[model samples]
Target: MKKMFAVTALVSAFSFSNVAMADEDIGCGLGTMVFDGKSGKVHKVLAATTNGTSGNQTFGITFGTLGCDGTGTITSSQKLAMFIDGNMDNLARDIAKGEGETLATLSEVWGIQDADKIAFNAVAQENFATIFASENVTSTEVLVNLNDLIAQNEALASYRI
Candidate 1:
């Protein structure tokens, strides 16, 4: 049981270390957001030390793959990009229709004022082709592309998190 205790302790320590780094992770590339509701540097060492040749299950188990910096100091464009990635399919369909519950969720998640959700939805719908060029897009790709579209619209650029 001592060996099991040691393993648990090590994992706990590693988890805490990563969680601790989320507070000041701005502009330092991007770190994995940990389960503790904080952002921290992605520790590739977990996979290395575990002595396994499997997929990135260790990292996925410990850290969420949302690609958010978790510092809560991100710009409006970045948050919108994250929203796009999270609500990709539903958002895409909503954009095509120019309205939906999913779009409302995106507006809520972005903290957009109720009065502005309609305009924002309209802008997103107008630029759906640019935002979602293809079905297969990476999170970073979504971020960059969404930011470009946000730049063209005043309402989107006004909402920042």
Candidate 2:
């Protein structure tokens, strides 16, 4: 199960995530239509299709673009949450080690800004056990817990996305 999730995360990262760059600007900012504007079923389908072609879609999503413009499937935050859940063990290990592919991949998946990244990683490294303490934790739960951790700490507040 764990391996399966890890594989899934890798697949998602390679196929859907625009990890190479850190910029927040994305195509037409249309992804925002899903959450901020009027996004009916038709709009959602159009956005998803546009997002597919737009390599930077996830960037807009993580920064509150809601890439797909739909409640169906998963949102960018949900995808990041699941990626973290699936890779928590490796993440903890990498955080403990201070560097690894796991950490790098997660950085991209979470879309942690370059400016806020070190602090965020440090927080994750410090709170690894608390953040990933349970195998039964859902993606949403992980998100809340992580955001809460960021909220409580001044230095990590930049991670709240």
Instruction: List runs of model 1 lying over 4 Å from the truth.
Output: 9-83
lDDT of 1 by residue, 1-161 (tens): 99879855654555555433332212121223323343333443331222223222334333532232333456665666666756778877887888999888877776779988888788778888777778766546655665566666776686633
Q: lDDT (0-100) at residue 65 of candidate 2?
A: 37
Every candidate's lDDT: 0.57, 0.60
Residue pair clashes in candidate 1: 22-39
Among all windows of 10 consecutive residues in model 1, the one with the lowest summed lDDT is 22-31
RMSD for each model, in Å, please?
8.7, 14.5
Q: After superposition, how far is residue 11 of candidate 1 from its true place, in Å?
A: 2.3
Q: In terms of TM-score, which candidate is strongest?
A: 1
* Local error of candidate 1 at residue 149 (angstroms): 2.1
lDDT at 18, model 2 = 41
Q: Supply candidate 1's per-residue lDDT for 121.
A: 81
Per-model TM-score versus the true fold = 0.52, 0.46
lDDT of 1 at 143: 55
Question: lDDT by residue for model 2 over 1-161, one digit each (tens)?
Answer: 99879845644544464433211222233343333344466665565455556443554445433333222466667677767756866866887766688887877777777887777778877886677668656545666777788879887665565
Question: Candidate 2: worst 10 consecutive residues by lDDT?
Answer: 19-28
